[model samples]
Target: MASPQIIADTEYLPTLLKLLDRAEKTIDIMEYSFAIGSATGRLNRNSAPFEIADKLIEIKESLGKKIRIRLYIEGYRETASRNMVTAEYLKEHGIEVVYGATHAKGFCIDNKFLLFGSTNLTQQSILKNHETNLLLNDKKAIAGFNKYFEFHWKGGGHGGVILPPPMIADGVFKDVLVDMIDRAEKSLNFSIYFFHISEIEKAFIRAHKRKVKITGLIHHHDAFALSYVRRTRGTAERMNDAGIKDLHYGPGTLFTHSKFLVMDNKEVMLGTGNWLHEDVEVHPQLYIHLKDPTLATNLTKHLQKTLRTVKRHRKEYTDSISI
Candidate 1:
């Protein structure tokens, strides 16, 4: 196992399962959603064992009081999931499970190990998308993440009903951008799939207009609906003309899905949501704002790798064009 590792999409599942087998004392899992294996068959053909609810029940039954487990996932009734049944099963088996407004994805093991990233431990996320996660044994980091988890868990962060942040109010997206751009003092680095709302683009344009350097890595795929493509193209042009350097295409197993914004050398934002209007409107999302240079630097290195990969892939296609 690589310490301070960077594993691609398909690589994390085996490691995750190995870790689960080794877990002894306790397991705390939080994710946006935790559907049963059957539910995932609708998306694709992979078993959703990582949901952990059923496994927790088995663990309790086998260990007979040696191991403990707790689960928390978003409680959305709009979707058909075995979440409530899983929770009830775990409870009946002496394991703790709660569902509400969770927007975080990660698991804490024995209160000593931490796994956090842009993955939900779900079937599609684990098998399909380009995702990233970190497994850290650092005590301080685990303590910090666990503290934040407890704060939200106690505050009913599991509620199904979402109260949209005021449409006009400055939101977490803007707050993250402003912090990154301010400290960037020199350059801002960003990579995202969509830039539909001016709220996000305005921050970049503002940075460019103020003479702060800006660089971006954007997806080239046109998978969005026609209406969305028109708006995103407009934003792309604005970004290009605003003196923002861009890496237009990204390469990976699937289209580029990671969302990251790093400003200057200081602040960073990474999450599951795009910098788009629907992200703030209908889609439930979560973004983490941090001042961790180590993470920011590593993410920058990944972006550099993406640029190289995209260049190589593009050249292969251009060279093969029939003359």
Candidate 2:
């Protein structure tokens, strides 16, 4: 069993490519968001979106029946245009494309290797977003993740039992987060994309009242940036006003798309979904929690590093990262 590897930001693309290159039997991609060309933001000819898509096509064309490549994408109307294009393009190249209201982002290769977390398969996500992903080959973790994916893939298993720890789904997201916040004794470090969830905000306030040190990094937004940032700022700023003044906005150049919480440097809840709302039942969502001190410390250090970058840069962080 190989230890889990933590991959972040620009490093995600190369690591993903390497994994796909090495995959022999299967490549299962369960992504929440995906787009290419103009939709992925400004990019030169050498774009991650194209590179990854081409790799999938090449694998299918070269290996043929020996390789089974399947891609699951979320089909929200906002991204329907580009996503439909991508889905049709991949289908033309011999890849199985399925669409649903997916909010899970993960990759399973040969039933052995797994890459799961906040990063999306997009140009902006690859080139600009400050994303965090975990790579693992452990059979236990792989089995659990596969079951989680299958449950959602099979229409919630016709109401089968949700898998055990490490894989959280739907309403369980809040329960895990609130429990962690309630248990915190020292600190809560957050780096989230959307963050208007009131109950989670209240939970943080309660934790702060308990003298738990709180620090956060939210992507700053103004009138632009697709109303997502604009809508989420109320709760984020409310948290800042409620005595958690350390909620600093991240660099405008990068979308802080990671959803993670490090509690007292002892545990981490990191995954794809944002803190946009408490109504987890609104979307089929998934997250993973780990109680490893080492992982927690590593992520805490990552947040501290991001805070340093946030302080040094100033290009009117109010501008949209979509540019």
Candidate 3:
């Protein structure tokens, strides 16, 4: 396997399962909307989480106390209920699971492989949603991620904060993202969901006005999600009016859920959480910065693929969710 590989779109679940099957000693996972087989109580044998649970069990037969899987959902309503049931099922299988506002998403397997990104552990995130995740097996990346996973795992009930190790414990993910955006030297290619965070938007505008080539996709403004139009509409108008015309939104509602920024096609910052101000203050978000050109290039390709499905204006974005 390559040291750094970009796993995007529908490639996430299969890659995850392959890693689980190959686990030699340890497997640690932290997901926001968790689900697994024998937990849905609907005999969901075909769900992505089902296959994930099945694979974990297959490995657990050999490495009992060594494999650790932790999933804490930050979702609401049905998602919360689903996470509880899944957590119980995993516990019965000797895997530790809990619930909280743990919005981080990643997988660290056997100290060699680490996958972190904007996708959750639910069926929709794995099998359907257009997500961005990076897989790293390089020594430094793997070591850092191992520290990152242990940092969260040790947090126990609260699912830890998203700062990762060696970073200041009091730091927040929004600052990290804003700082990265503020320092943009050349360009940014992004595919993000929920654009309600004004500070990040302001930093983005600053970069754009400085002649940074900013382009990316957003979830269509007309989705059925709560206040969906309001969130995306303001963002779209602000960017468009600022002369950032390379923006596109749509490919339906679900496909644009990627939250990632590739800086100059050299570094990638990706993981869970929307850019909503209220959520940023309360939720445990994960945003990692890696200076890997190969990963950034792959993420850019992922963002550009949807340009064919998105429209530039508000009146044309086809809503995937019916009102």
Candidate 4:
């Protein structure tokens, strides 16, 4: 399958809205944050043209019982948390709302189209912040994610289930990195805005020893870069000693706030998860693993272009890598 087209800046709205408008059976949304008001001051009202809240309401009314809507929002009531009113309104029309304490975000529409992205479907993310999402039409892939969704939906309280221990416990960051490294076959290409986890450092070192080609991007502006520079220097030294190739760095402003990984050109993982101790250890983070090269290759090209323009400050990670 060819990779889905890359849409960035303000160009994503039309295609995304079209997908929404074409939905026939159901819409399942798991969001970390959701809002309807102007999260960005620039907008007189909400930033996105169509309110997600309103869309659900309209679908319920027009489609009647044929439309099944499921919404999962994370966390309890907090001052600045995403509003639950959206869920409440949906319930009045017979839509179900599931509240979760987990922080990951994913959604499936009609069990065919899947969207996994960095944004939380909130006003701030859709209209104010930079965000990216993947659209997959693969049946197996959709089923895999839907299974995850169903697991949580059924296990979550009221309308869903909370995850059990180990999966829900702290310190899964190391395990996740190890899983990624274990899954890497020929190469590992990862870009992180911030990376300071000690265990993850070890995982990469271990992969390098096993002959996995590991390339990485670390933002210069992040505090973790200073620490990573110091820690990865030894890893690079070891790789150099073993005749392994040096790691490459993607180019961008001092700030590159994307966490993505491409493995063996066969899979791509993108999302809100950063390679940081905090993200790995404490923060609720989510990521989508895309197994199609069409999606992986395009993202590879973009990262390569960005990496090319970077200026090297450290000798361990490439001074510059062009995507």
Candidate 5:
């Protein structure tokens, strides 16, 4: 089995670009959103989004018909024009571009390597947001994702809907998560953004009652706070009240946009989707559950280190919960 490595924050863009530059035979990209502009924010250093796009274009132009490049993008109604423009730009540059309703983000290079996670190919996602991605060199894992890519490439469902197989389908996400939490023997750690699902909160409460150590890092920026203050704050208060006292708000520098769970350092669930009830019901998300001890240990250490840097909200339970 090839060892998995976790790539987080702004590192994903540059690493992905390097892979794109080195791709020998084929490059398959699946992203939920795409924009043509520069990446901005603290970590990105004003990097241009076209830096990656242009590199792919350059490879296609230089390699001529020897290389195969296909980009599958989400066809969101609100951003149809932008997707169309980006698709046209790539199509003009010898790359095949297709639009579909997908919330999956991943890249497959030469059918030997794969990178997939919650990060989208946009300015905010690449440069500004706190994203989590896993790079795998394992042939089996690569082949599995390649199969998924091929399924979507051939247009599996109506209106270009790409569905994961039954084992890891969307319908099982909540059930799998709750089961993982329920089966935790030692610890449950999660770092997430926009976590408003009540079932997950109840799971945490139940785990706390089971004497399992639970820790969470939730997003607390103005962008999320403005729209989801009640949900975010209320969840934190409820968790704290339930005795999971290690809950902390995200650091100011990064957006804490990762959605992952580490159960007892034995299994890791990494993927897209904000753990929102509506997202589970409607959005097309993808996640992989791995039983690699090395990855679980590394991710656990990383989450603990990140938790140390975050600010914990001191709660004073009065007549009502604070938002």
Candidate 6:
């Protein structure tokens, strides 16, 4: 089996664009958030997110019916306007665009390459944020991702009804995560964007009580400026107080937008949703659990390396807390 390659930072966007440029047969995309233009506060002028959308449009226009392009996006009405406009534009140009509560960030190119991870197809994710993705040239891995996409493409519904599989479905995923954490024998490593679920927090506390080495890396910025930061900080502090000593916050320069967990260097879980209750209950998300030791070890090492770059928060909570 060909091993999957981990791509991070600036390499992700260019690599995705190159794959899209080279695709000949089909392009399947699943994203939680996708925008056409540059994101606000973007430093670079040459935006890769817009370039990717433009590339897909160009492919559809140039190939006409020769190429097949399908995009499955999250269609919650609150954020529906932008995605709907993009969907309409793509549909008008002959691309198949389906909107649902999709939170899976991935792409399958001509059945030859599969890329999936924490990176959303947005300007912020591609150019400005810190993200991690796995690119697989292995046929077996590609087949698995293809199966997942096909299952959702046919059975998925708008809102929160799109069920990919029983193991990773809504409510089930939360149980699976808690079970995974509870069953950890040696270590638990996690890199998450947002986390507010109490069950998950209690599971980690339990693991720590069992003498399991628990470590985590979370984003410093609260997605929204209002209560999001407060909630995130509260969760982090609570976890720290509960005995998960190694939890560290990522720097504000690049958002740590990865959602993954490694248990005992033997199993790994990667997915789209934050560890929040609403994400699992109301949003369409994908969670892939694997027992590959190689992948798990690599992800664990990556997490440790990323943690080294950021400052560790003091083990003290202040009354005047601000994220």
Candidate number with greatest lDDT: 2
Q: Residue-pair clashes per candidate, as listed?
A: 6, 0, 1, 18, 0, 0
CA lDDT scores, all candidates in order: 0.60, 0.78, 0.68, 0.58, 0.74, 0.75
Q: Identify the candidate with maximal TM-score.
A: 2
Relative to the unseen true structure, what is the C-alpha lDDT of residue 286 in candidate 5, on a scale of 0 to 100?
71
Candidates 1 and 5, the one with greater TM-score: 5
Model 3 scores a TM of 0.83
Evaluation by TM-score, superior candidate among 5 and 6 = 5
Query: Per-residue error at 255 for model 5, in Å?
Result: 1.3
Which ten-residue region of model 4 has the weakest summed lDDT? 161-170
lDDT of 3 at 51: 79
lDDT of 6 by residue, 87-186 (tens): 6667877889877767778889999887888887667788777688888776655665666677668865424343433225444567778988999999
In the range 145-219, model 4's lDDT, one tens digit per residue, is 565566657763321322332122223434655677776777877666556665666667777777888776554
Lowest summed lDDT across 10 adjacent residues in model 3 is found at 162-171
Model 1 segments beyond 4 Å from truth? 1-8, 35-62, 77-95, 137-144, 151-173, 209-213, 219-233, 251-253, 277-287, 315-323
Per-residue lDDT tens digits for candidate 1, residues 9-102, read 6776777666776788888877775555444343212365434455566667777678877776667644326555445545777877666655
Per-residue lDDT of 257-318 in model 2, one digit per residue for the tens? 88889999999888777776633656666777888788888889998987787665655554
| Model 1: pairs clashing at backbone N, Cα or C within 3 Å | 100-158, 100-159, 101-157, 101-158, 101-159, 184-264
**What lDDT tens digits, residue by residue, belong to model 3 across residues 1-323?**
46367787789888888877888777777677776543345547778787787777777767876665554444454467667767777677877664555666788887788887777777778877777787777566556555555555555423243443322221265777788788888988887777787888888899998899998677764436758557776887787888888776555645567887788888777767677765466555566677778777877776776565343333454453211
List TM-scores for all candidates, in order. Answer: 0.72, 0.90, 0.83, 0.67, 0.86, 0.84
Q: Which ten residues in a row have the lowest lDDT in candidate 1?
A: 161-170
